[model samples]
Each structure stands twice: as structure tokens, then as C-alpha cells.
Target: MHGTALSGWLLVAVCTATGAYCLLRLRSDCARARSSAGGEAVMGFGMAAMAVPAAFAEPPSWLLAGYAGVFAAAALRAGWLARARENGGGHHLHHVIGSLAMVYMALAMSAPGGHTAHEGHPGAAGGVPLVTGALLVYYVGYVLTTGARLLPAAVTPRGGGTLAWRARPELTLACRLSMGIAMLAMLLAL
Candidate 1:
């Protein structure tokens, strides 16, 4: 593969690995709480929504269709969680926003005239600007919100003093930063 292609695959690999870590962490939390697997599953699905595009960079038409299906499912789950009376465990709104960002990346990859599409062409001036701007905003929001939630969790003690370090806080921050950088890279690539 060419350098660009290699870089693309690397991006996919990073995203999928991080997403997997997040899924496992949530699963462990579920196990600890003795709760149903529903919440963990939903979060896993959201992370999977992100991994789909990354894992299938030059996917066949059917693969893209599958990506669309997963994204739809993720969106439904996010909406349901949003309407819940009390959000719990993870940061519901922030995850929803991050999920939406993944949706944007997937859509951008599949959209007509996008760089990755078969019949791709340069987008209209305004179109590229609008989409890229929105994506940047989305990642920034993801970073800020996830960071805010993580600060306390990483610092607060469970019984009396905080743990040395918290995985969720660290991972959440890393994900946010990487996503923001990825968004910038995408904009520059455009």
C-alpha cells in the first residue's frame, strides 16, 4: 500500500483498539455492578459504529451498507439513552456526541464526491467548509466534555482517596485528543 493508504489503516487500527479497550472497560464495570449487560452492549455498539469505517477503508458496497446499519442502531441507542430519566455509569451526552462524530466521519467517507468514494470529486467550496467545520466542532466538544467529566473521576477517591490513575479518564481524554487531531488531519487532507 502507498503511504497514505498505510496511514489510513493505522488510523483505523488505533481507533479500533481504543474502542475495544473502552468496550472491555464498560463490560468490567457492568460485571462489577451486577447489572444487565444492556448498557455495556450499547456502549460497545457505539464504539463499533466508529470502528466500522476505520476497519473497512476500501469496503465493498455491502460493507458500506452494513456500516450504515450499525450507525443507525447506534443513533437509536443514543437517543434512547438521552431520553432516559437518569443517565448513569458513563457520560451519556458526551458519548452521544462522540457517536455523532463517528457518524459524520462514516457519512463523509460514503458521501458522493468524498475522497474515499469510487466516483469522488472535489466538493463544493461551501460544502467542504461546512462539513469540516462541523466535524472540528464535534471533536472539540467531545474533548471538552469528556475532559470535564474525567477530571473529577480521575481525582476523586473511591473510599477515602483517589486511585493512582483511572483508565476511563485517561482513555477518554486520549480518545478525545486523537479524534480532534484526526478531524484536523481530515480537514487538511481535504
Candidate 2:
């Protein structure tokens, strides 16, 4: 496999793992799981479409339009949710930006003329660079900040059954880190 395909497959793997885990976690915590299930599904499906090999090639135009429409709708819904709740925090902002980044990626893949699919082509013109750059910066910062948050020692639990990191969701953090890496890979592929 070439570099592009390899990156795409790796991204798919990350997203698939995230989506599956999110679904499983949903059984345990309905409210928290409800918020992320749709996003995770989109991530998995989008990455899978991107990762499909040439031997079983699907048209880029189709994939691009589908992903663009899905993510655009998702962004709009997220915006309305934010507005209804008197707005939210970085989580809401990240969802909006992430959806936009996917939309940008889809459009970049669907550039007019005879340009080939994948990044590093003339297809990546227009707003692709700016959007991809912003996403890369944001994900990188998130990973770093999250890592920093993990560094400070929490008060040690006294009881034998106590969990020190009760508030932190390790699985979700792992998924976020994987997504961050996937975002970096996608931008680099560009």
C-alpha cells in the first residue's frame, strides 16, 4: 500500500475503534453516550469511505458530496443545540470545527477538473489549507493540554475501592487522542 492508503486505513482503524467503544460505553451511561454516538458514527463512516482501496474504487464525487452533506447537517444541528443551551464550551466549538474540517476535506477531494483524489493535489486549493491548518493546530493543542492535565497528581484515594480519576474517561480520552492523530495524518497527507 502507498503512503496515502496506509494513512487512510490507519485513520479508519482509529475511527472504527472509537465508534465501537462509544457504542459499548453507551450501554453504561445513556446521557454521556447519547451526546457522542452520532459523531462517532460519522467519523467511522467518513474515515471508512476515505480508506477504501483503489481495487474497489468508488467515485470521489459521490463520497465527497455524501460526507459534505452529512457533516454540514451535523454542524448545523450542533449549532442549534449550542444556541438553545445558551451556548456551550470548547466541546461544542470543537464539534463545529471538526465537522467543518470534514466538510472541507470532502470538498477538497471533489475539486473540479481532472485532478486525482487524495491530498497533495491541486485539488487542495481554496479554503482547504486554512481549514486543515486550523484543525491541525487545534487537535495538537488538545492532545498537549490533555496530556498536561494528566500530569498533575490527584489526591490519592484512601479507600481500597476508590478510584482517583473518577471524573476522567480513559476510553474517550484514548479515542480523542486517536482522532487527533488521524487529523494530523489527514493534514499531512494533504
Candidate 3:
């Protein structure tokens, strides 16, 4: 019921900063994955960019514009990369899903008064808040799965365990943790 301007701006700032950090961390990981897996880093950057404007701007229109633009660009870029894959690899599916979820959350958040046909209806969807919650779930899952994939790569791998516990895991953890925090912010907005 409360939609304070300060809170809204704060939400945008937090999400943007965290998302930017994640993208930087992902850049390093993508460099390492380049020889083996080419596009995940770029795709991750695309996802990070999608959330940036939403996180920094107040009101849905400005945020949504950035969100829509980034999402569209990502979809196109992803499609082009997919076409070039010998194995038709879709490694960036996590980024794709995460980005889509962020855009969804942005849309719902930007909705006027958080009101829609579903608002206050018993059997209705509970409007924007419900959609935001669903998006949070998807974002969380995407972060978890991507984290799991990065974990093994980061481990030093000695006798089926990590050793030295090098930089990759640290960077990967940074990316995943930032993403988790961003998603939590979205949840708070609801």
C-alpha cells in the first residue's frame, strides 16, 4: 500500500550496483570459459545490463524502457550466438531466464498503483505483487543453478575436492551472491 519515492529510488540504486558488480565478476569467468564455452559471459553481461536501468531509475516507464531494450537486444544476441554453435549449445539459458524474470518484475513493479483487473479479486492473481513473487522465484533458481555450475570449475579439484580454492570460485560466488541480493530487493519491493 505504501509507495514512497525514496524507497523506490533506493531499490533501483541497490539493484543497479549489485547487478553491475555481478556483471564484472562474470566477465572474468567468461574469459576463462571462452575456449570451451564462448557466449555465457557476454550473455551474462546482457542480463546485468537489463537490470541496471531498472535498479537506478524511479517510476516504471524509465526503468521499463531500459529493461525492454536490454531484453530485446539479449534475445537477438542469444539467437545469433545459438546459430553459430556446433553443438547448438544454449549455455546462456540461465542468463536468458534470469533476464526475462527481471523484466517481468520490472513490468509488474512499474504498473500504476500496482492495480490491475486481478487486484483484490478472490480468485484473481493478486496483480503485480504476485507476478513479482513469481519472478523472484525464477531469479533465485537461475542464480542457484548458475552458481552450482561455476562451483566445480572454481574448486582446485584435488581427490574430488577443492584445493587452494582459487579466484574463479570467488568471482563466481560474487556474481551469484550479487544476483541473489538483487532478487531479494525485488522481493522487498513487493
Candidate of highest lDDT: 2
Model 2 Cα RMSD, Å? 4.4
TM-score (C-alpha) between model 1 and the true structure:
0.61
Query: Which residue runs does candidate 2 get wrong by more than 4 Å?
Result: 53-58, 84-89, 113-127, 150-168
Q: Residues 1-190, candidate 1, lDDT per residue (tens digit)?
A: 1126556555556655555555555544433322212433443444434333333455454655565566566666756666654554244454455455555555555555443423344452123577668767866675577567556644444576543322344654565555545544544443
**Predicted candidate 3 versus true structure: per-residue lDDT over 81-188, tens digit per residue:** 555556343545544555565555545545664322354653221235566667667767767776776766544544675433123455545555555555555454
- Write down the TM-score for model 2: 0.74
Model 3 bad stretches (over 4 Å) = 1-57, 60-63, 79-91, 114-133, 143-154, 157-167
Off by over 4 Å in 1: 1-3, 29-57, 88-90, 116-121, 124-128, 145-156, 160-168, 176-190
Error of 1 at 78 (Å): 1.0
Predicted structure with the largest TM-score when compared to the true one: 2
- Each candidate: how many clashes? 2, 0, 1
Please state the error at residue 161 of candidate 3 in Å: 18
Local error of candidate 1 at residue 137 (angstroms): 1.5
Model 2 lDDT per residue over 19-136, tens place:
6765665554345445655565566556656555433464568767888898898787666555544334346556677777778767765666323444665443334566667778
